[model samples]
Target: MAVRYIPYYPDTLEGQARLDNFVRTSRMLFYKDNNQVKTRIQRGMPLYEVTESETVGANPDGNIVMHGECLSTCAYLKDKGIEIDLVYIDPPFASGADYAKKIYVRRNPLVQKAINEAEQQLDNSDMQEFEEKMYGDIWDKEHYLNWMYENLMAIKSVMSDTASIYVHLDYHIGHYVKILMDEIFGEENFRNEIVWCYYGPGSPGMRNFNRKHDTIFWYSKSEDYQFNDKDIRIPHDAKTLDNFKKGLDGSGFISENYDLDQNGKIPEDWWEMAIAGRFPKDGVKRVDYATEKPWALLERIINASSNEGMLVADFFGGSGVAAAVAHKLGRKFVHNDVNINSIQTARDRLVSAGAEFTMMEVRDGVRLFRNPVQTMEKLVRLIPGLNTETNLDKRFWAGSIYDSQKGKMPVYLPNLMDSSSRVMDKTEMNHIIREALPDLGNDVKQIVVYYIDVEDIEELRQFIHDENTQTDIAIELRDLKQVLDDVVIEDKATWEMSQVQVELFTKWQIKMLTFHSDYVMKKIEAFNLIGDQQHQKKLANNKKSTFKPIKISDEGLECIEWLSVDCTNAQKDAPWHSDAEVKIDKTGTVTVNGTKTRNLWDATIQSDDKPLRLKVRNICGDEVLFVL
Candidate 1:
């Protein structure tokens, strides 16, 4: 059997290796249990396939994913030659505390006290206390800055020559990220340290002053970057316009031969906009996500910074306000987040706002399109016992049918990414199933394909023929049932999985794997923390853990195969076997299946006074790794 493993190490390590690069046991591994692994793999597979199938387009060309890592977005979009126009990132405040959703009301004593004090001190009605608690002293400032800097580096490469980026932070990391942005986008393109004052208030008993504002650092790739100044003009109130008119001599309305009303005043750097809050008056139902930015704020920045049809990218999209506003205003937007729930919220918000798009598929080189939800459901129906939990289910739907459908018939399924598979409607599913049916035969009989693991093909055929030899064509379920009364279910084991067939299988597989991985990883981490010293040592003392081996999948194999055939940048970035070599103990050898690599761990060794720790270095940035 020809098998390929996704490389866990790079050919070379670039720059100095930091302890942070390793998957710290303290933090949950990306895929810990079979479930979590399955989810990541399954959810990720369809997306990966869809992305791989996309044709490269010049300018702002790329798919907008509602979920997944930020690095993946940069990698995906870059493959399509799509340099982003602007990236407005508002990542979680990185406070170690869990961010609870507000669906069920619960009070944090500390937060409550702070809010009360903020209310008492507010001298302006507009000044809200929410900001002071959430954005003010939330996280360790240094960690926020460092975490943000590392993530922003990935965003830096995706910017266009005429692009600009905005970093939304509070007094905490605003100034710090600003300095980092100055370094990244260049000091010359550092446009402004915009002060957004939601309120003008002061705490009466404070020693220094009361805080009532946030900051956004604007940076551009070049001095001649896109800034449609007129697009963000503030209409002078009737009085100011009248005053200007009066100053003009009458026909006279123009001492100079220029139209006055046509020109609006350029907005000042200090913007006084309403802070996003729970009140319905603020516009839209309040979403449950913490730190949701107001659409109005995004509107101002997007209008001033970019043009229509240009791409607007936001990686740290909490409620997807920026992406929602972007799509509403006719601009292409790509919003990314690691949290599935958050991305779903964004996608639903967009769908509700009436954006049109559909997932597509390409069967036998004939592209077909269908509704996203329907596509997912049809896939599930096709594969027996395969539900959304399987890794294969999502891949089968999203990769094959979804891609083909989106490319072929974009009309039926508008706006590809929808809510979770659980939320899809049956009506939508029916429409999608109808749309996705292969253009096989014209006789009205519904023919669905199945992929089973059984090895007896002749037995399966005989069983099917014996069972349903008298079946005939049918249109409706009622009609099908009439025909099925005489027909039999066929067994076609060992048949190749089609886009439709695989989509169904992959969904169930993905869910199962993700749940398994997440569960296992959490247990492993917890056990290491509280388990016996020897057990902890056993878990931690690894060149690579015995429990956690570097394993690659068939998808990974395909990516490597593509790389072998096509030396494209997209292929080069695919997860594959690592080619890098790191210094290791001559006595120790690390084994992955039949292959062995030098082991970095030793029985008796130290980096300085510390015991030998397995370290991985990537010389070439091609492989994806799992560390124990």
Candidate 2:
């Protein structure tokens, strides 16, 4: 049957125009590729190597944890021709809340060194900005819709034709997102609007009824999709069993000829599932993640939609309930999220659950050199009679140098490193020169080059000299470092590390361990103060503020959020086989002096392994894993 369209406010001419623009932008998904900074890194980045201990080895079906923007990660999967059978994303509900987790300082030497360096660089006021927020849920209605639309479009591209996707949302924007999902996945593919109702403490409100339920919109990629109804049946109580018997006609079962299966009854659209907080302290699967869903919820979704060995994915990956549950159910999974805290939490959870997954992040091989053109501006100021004009084409030209005696000379800043961060070779240099030739007109006689590092300076000069001779244009290669040294350019070159090391330490027993990482310190230094203040204020005002800012101490352990250790069997060939583990969930309390301090995690190990595998996650979700 065709979908019936009702005339709504958005159907009006003016509203239609706005909606059309949004749809167009969503289809194009320009935001994913428009991040120029990230694009540059993607063009030149390298994947971090999976260590021997982390590798699942020769298995094509092992799970994956990707730390990146979901859109980019989904696009990456699509480009790789990997299709997922099931995708369940619990994206931000646009609830206008800031989620955060408290982190502690690890008492490791490497971490201490980073802390010392940070203390020297930043003052007490700067340390106040170290609070880690997982992700912001606040968004302008239009912006949120457009962002979700683009991500959905990208996600749909990587889904198998027989795939199913469950989008978890709440009262705020569920209805609007349904329309967007219908447009992208087709109205015919719409399956169910599953209402996940839970009982929790409620407060009286004058405006409306208490909202104690969240909506999960299910959609299939095609008409033919997987639905294992038997796997997701709910148990029938004695009252229901008796009622069925009463309804039975002459036959021994319900109705005239029906037979009741031993398996439980199939669940209806309205489901009664408890939230994670309602679980007891010793519950089978309860992790104190702010937005964590119950494992049972994920289990039902995964079992009903996908079979064993089928690929499952969750891009939002909060606390990794879906991935954790999916692994336990014997399904291959891929989880992606931008928050380092989520990544760390999910990695630890999955590892402790005996799931083998490789961790990966999109990283550029060459660090982004800060203000390369600013150096050129400095050079023009230092040299006599040298004036420079900014160029329209930033890719090749930094600016053009103008001299009263000499004709306009174009300046080019060639990339010192190739896509892989290796020093540019002769052929690469020749290509750059060839591409720049057309832009340099007959009036232009000289081209100034500024480079940080070159493989062979003499060879490059010779190559440029030969090109100059052939084209009757002088090509001058100038070292950028030398120019900075000679002329005072108060600029520091900043570069991001392609790979960061994860430090692990074992205390006395196999059960106890400590972990430290410099990655957390780096994130703290890079955190934007303006954004942090806004986030802190938002968190403070909200009733859901579970995080308390830790007072800065000399130890500088404020960046460590949570840590998990999985004591895997050392004698066994499978590194992911866990014997026992400990999970440390830290929170801060105010001291008498009004100082917020976190309790240390002195874990008691239950396994026999001497060097336990530890996963240390910082507040931002970045993690470092090593043998302690």
Candidate 3:
């Protein structure tokens, strides 16, 4: 009999101690009923469902774009018994860059006058809001690796046994992640480390080689996987073509008199492909996204790995290139990302490309309740004679509570933290308590720990007792529900408009429409509240200095960022025409109908009996479609 060995690295003594305790107490967290444990951990997280207005049910073989965390979204698919045939993920490279997009808002002359007058009255305190962040790639090395590990594990669970995956990365942490993928997919299953080389304009680095390529690690779930080499063949170079010999087959060339077509050879592991760049006049496949990949890059990957009608997924869908390419190639797709900007950009691009797909989102209202420290703070305010102190070392402690009878008791709280429904085990508890023990002093006799739900409390208590035989400390487990009795927080989103107003502009001989919505900016806060402390602080300063919250008004429109109108008369299968659009860029420049405007939009339209479809996207990418 042999045992398997797991590889891990802990840089410091404290990290090593945490790992030791984690391994020792891991058994106590294993539950017999896995579903029960999952339910408890996922109780307050949002449940993902398709939006009715965006559903394209008639197209059964179409694709999907889900706006949510990939981990939970993948688990949701697994529960539905939907297995993916191909996976291509271009996740964050941990490059420590803050990516943002310049969004434009359409403005009316009446609205501009009101805005100008209001600005003068306030002494220029108000500034226009426009730019929206996509997602941040900065992370601590350990945290980044762990985050990638959890997401990869969840993604693997939804992949078919015969499926292939392509993990894209850069120089920063690709080597570290290569080992992780080897462990998860197995060393024997490693397929190829494809190098994607590209040339772009940038400043020459004096200290190091100019980085111009990215690594794409390919792996398969099983030995038997789908591959189509002929579909991805390229044209041979002139030198290779000249070496071919005349073949017996008509107009064919061969190396040794065998019939072989003049078509190019198979591409090697190193590929030469240009990245997607801006060419507004040249009809190139380019969007305003900062990190968009060329369609050729994704097309090759999709064609070689999967067949028509197979499900292909890109969980880290940056600009929807994978979904767009997948749709064009007649393959089904599931595109997901945590950033709302990515969702909006993908939705617009796919719809414009005539992609029949439904839009979905995980209801995010339950997130505010899942924070342990916030919930504990509420509990302390509600309950008397319970004093709490903050611990700088521990991550999830609302601080230790001081009850007169219990003396100074250290309190521990567990949270969902991410999209996974996995509960914390005894090992994690031991690690947290061990770090906090020194601060509590050696004389402490008792400690209290609270959890939403656990597999076995007695087993955890026994494990803790066994580890601390030298000291007599009684470990007690408390249910978290005891603190959250009948408390509820209402959703902050509010709307004021009931209908859209369309008026005939007799002088311009066109229709003029006025859109109104106070709730347009309701979800703007979600984008700013992301990442660790440094990221959050950067977001806060950006919001404070560059933009201000739009004030709700009944007589004038506010907080609307982007608007598109579809004037197509056909009811079904008709392409969505961009009749008119308005947006505000990052520099406060307003543009309407592809022309710069003086803080206003000159919109004109023809009045028609056929219903007109309008899509209004707010600053945070939350959109609502209306028919008039």
Candidate 4:
């Protein structure tokens, strides 16, 4: 749904008529063809991406967003198939204007202490810069609504059948945003307008009553929601617990004046907890970001409404206190925020408690959260060739999968079809075969071939034999089949190596390498090489490591190479002879080899007679000379 807010419509007819007098500004987001992911990568930045899984179950997966605007934590959870059981959003309080306090060294000393602590916790330098940028800056209430609306709409999609949504807001735009939520989530789902009351020093605005409490609007996606009241019950009042003393003769004096039950008394809706500075000594303070809710408060909400493994989403994951509470309680969390500083602060807090998170941005510039390991696993399942064999959890490099018992099966393998007589068959193909074969027992004698191609079964069969020639290998050829009836075994003379098999396998091998040559190198080099440029140097300095070469698959290579060559090698002929530019799989063996071609550099160079012209227009209405 499109972003909805009161600002979208004029509040009065006078306001409507004067709408044209307002500033007409447009924020256009253009989706780039490139995927540089410029926002979050930097030196000392916490490696939030789950590159490895913990062998021991010490750390759990959590999602944290920093910097970019967030539209929907629920939608993000839905994308990952993590059904959210509850959503706790403490959006910006629209008290006429959004208020964000400063947390910088230049600010007050208390604020500086908080900033210093936050900075120490952050490992990423680029992220640190982002925090600095947001330091003291506050947003307009209208902007906050626009930001909240865009993200909350996406979040609604990720709620489970029995999910509940709780929104915490102060007197500001609490009623306004509530009306929006009622319309968006349906008025029937509205559960309660929980009044969180606290007695505090009254504000100086004596003309009106002092506002000492905030409102929490509780709503559910469906009538059936997860509300475990027992989890949030409070200890019985001293007087109530002592009632048993009068009722029962042998009741302990500890319960002298109140009635005591084995189970705790359910806390009332208007229950009061220690507010802010008055919290228990053991309770932590939210010194960095002002207006942060207490952990105990969030704990009550989470424990009372969510299951152990159920996802808990927080779109306005402010200082991340809610996320931290969720982690401590053993529930997965998908936390989002537009402010980069908030995400960084949240991440530092979560990581200290031993949780990992991955970050992504949506189309509308909102940052999102996901479990990194889960994300990687899903990608592998969807794209077959993206196997993480070497670094079981690392990104995929172009390679084939071989089963000693079931032969070799290449899924989305490269297309490097070449015909070369001197191609190394046994050594190259043997290497791949050895690598692909999962370690069965050493004494296993039977052998079989499982080729996974509907179109080129014969080529795969020949390729297998071309590498294992004269080995006394007894092989059963299983044609690639998605179903039993789809199998087709060509009538080859023998199961062992043949000249036709060798020739065909060689060509198929070449085709495979050619297809994924660029991508393979990009992956390997990303882990090994560094880009040379001013911005890259800054990135390296901030990241403490070279940025991995972003993936440039065969599909994306045409565009990347065009940009690279057009800018750097404009004078030199476009060269294609670099072996580094391509991969070759031939005759059961693989090699990185190719030839470069010298071609015209530019349109003018390609057309010898082409001319360039430059014209200048004078500011004083005089035309300058044109050069050709």
Best by TM-score: 3
Cα lDDT computed for each candidate against the true fold: 0.43, 0.59, 0.60, 0.43
Model 2: what TM-score? Answer: 0.55
What is the per-residue lDDT of model 4 for residues 1-628, given as tens digits with 9 covering 90 to 100?
Answer: 1121111111111212121233336733222211111111111011112222111123345454433333333333444566678899886564543334332111122322454667744222221100111222233444444444434545565677899988898876676567557655777788888888777777676787777788888888778988887787777677666665456556454444654556777776774655763433433346356657777678888998897877787876777877777877878877676554465457545644556565444332111112112222233343433344532211112323456554443332211111010122233334335543333233323343332222244554587666544343444543322222232121111011112234335211111111123222433453334344544778757855444333333322111111000111222222111112121111111111122222211101111122122111111111112112
The window of 10 residues in a row where model 3 has the poorest summed lDDT is 1-10
Residue 13, candidate 2: alpha-carbon lDDT: 19
> Per-residue lDDT for 377 in model 2?
31
Q: What tens digits encode model 2's per-residue C-alpha lDDT throughout 1-628?
A: 0011111111111222223344553383222212322222233222222222344334477678886656556655755578899999998898998766544433333433465667743222322434445555766675577567656766787789999999999999998888778777878789999999998766765476777999999999889999999998878888678877687464345555666766987899998888863432322355546798987788889999999999999998988888878887889999887665567667666655657777766432222211222223345555544444554365666567776666777766543211211233455456557777666667877777655445567887787767645466777766555544663312111111122222553332332233334545444444545555767787888844333333333444344454344554443333443343334333322111112234323333333344455444444444445454
Q: Which structure is stronger by TM-score: 2 or 4?
A: 2
Q: Across residues 1-628, which tens digit of lDDT does each residue of candidate 3 receive?
A: 0011111111111211121122334443221233332332333222344232355434587467886677657756765678899999998888888677654333344555665678743222344444555555656665566667656766787889899999999999887778767756776778999999999666766676678999999999889998898899988876555555434344355435554455667799998887863322422256678789888788899999999999999998988989988888889999887776777678766755667777776543332232222333356654444445554345545556666676766666554334332334565665555665555666566777766544466777777777755445666777655556555432122222233355642211122344444323433333333323446577778853332343444432334556655555334334445555555433334545445555543333322323366556554454555554
TM, every model: 0.42, 0.55, 0.62, 0.42
What is the TM-score ranking, best to worst? 3, 2, 1, 4
Q: Could you list the CA RMSD of all candidates, in the order they appear?
A: 28.0, 14.1, 10.8, 29.0
| Candidate 2 residue 278 C-alpha distance from true site, Å | 8.5
Give candidate 3 misplaced runs (Cα > 4 Å): 1-53, 103-133, 201-205, 245-260, 277-285, 363-365, 368-391, 394-417, 420-427, 440-558, 563-616, 622-628
Give the alpha carbon lDDT tens digit for every residue of 22-71 in model 1: 35568632211223222322232111223222211231433464444454
**Preferred candidate (TM-score higher): 1 or 2:** 2
